[model samples]
Target chain A: MADKKTKNVFKKGAISSDFIGTSIAKHQSKTTIGAHNIFLGQVRADVIDNKTVAAIEYTAYEDMANEKFHAIREATFKKFDLTCMHIYHSLGTVKAGEICLFVFASSPKRKIVFKAIEYIVEAIKADVPVFGKEIFEDETHQWKVNK
Target chain B: MTINVKYFGLIAEITTCEKERILFTKKNVSEFLELLYLKYPSLKNKDFQVAQNQELVSQDALISGHELALLPPFAGG
Candidate 1:
């Protein structure tokens, strides 16, 4: 069994394009990986009740969140044939239009990668104990809920 | 026995603290929740779930783990 100890999936803030680029560039050496699908979750400036969101402050039960991520990763591996996977989420404040979550999956075939990406993302949304407080431009806030 | 209860999100706002340690007996989670509601009546109407040792648990489940958390709905991507 793979060590199931929690793996930290959180970065301190918004995921940078440079970091994502570097991640993809490093995978070039893995010639066996024929398909790589990526999911990037960007924060949206949602307007509600005449308030426009400016940013989001995210928090999580860190220990539990990491454990859940590990479990999800293992489940994805068991359900699909894949070469590698990477998941990342942001902690603290992330502005609207910034990337907050990133999931990357690689496999030998295109079909597996496509299905695996959606599965992994939905699992993260429902299972992880992360919370987001959306801050509006006027300093009001609201808790976010996944649909 | 004494257990540590951690609160998150709006629950923390109601409790005015992130965590607290309290004395408890060996019983089902529902009973423990009753005690919590007595202490923080505002929590009685709040929507949340219980996690024992980092696992989502039912109210009928036994309370064994030292770490217990009150979690609100998740909103992650």
Candidate 2:
């Protein structure tokens, strides 16, 4: 039951770097996995119709986003034998080409960790309620959800 | 009663404010939307979602005096 409780971590808005690092350290155990896989998502500067995107502003319906994130974390744990997992997303304003999300998963072996990492990242992109705003160098902006 | 309504993304652009309190009938979600649309006709066709008290709900869902938010389709990484 304690193991089940440790599998999911969700918070409103962006997660700090210290939180991500500490979460991994807390889950480290002798009986747990020897290998951990992490995936970090960052925004990129892309030109759309001759306008270059300078940065991205991230936002969320905080109440709903938090609920959805927690639900997804629980679902991921049930689907896999993960020793632990962590997910963090940005909120408010994040510049283009900046880090937006960090996902880390560890298990008992290489195979499970690899599979779990893929699953968690995919689930976050597909299911989470976080949204992004694409800011152009020209000072215009547009909102986008990860696809 | 007057309830506070929050707008995000493109919806904020139309409303010109992030939060506002409007006089509304104590009606279901759909009825409130009808009133909102009448006030901001430009929002009638834009693809957006709604949430009450931080929970996502369908347009026709029932709501009463809860915090409401209008979210345009999300574009986050």
> Global lDDT of each model?
0.93, 0.73
Q: List pairs with backbone clashes in candidate 1.
A: none
Model 1 spans > 4 angstroms off: A1-5
For this target, which candidate reaches the highest DockQ against the unseen true structure? 1
Backbone Cα, N, C clashes tallied per candidate: 0, 11
TM-score of chain B of each: 0.96, 0.90
Q: What is the lDDT of candidate 1?
A: 0.93
What overall lDDT, based on C-alpha atoms, would model 2 receive against the true structure? 0.73
lDDT accuracy of residue A57 in candidate 2: 75
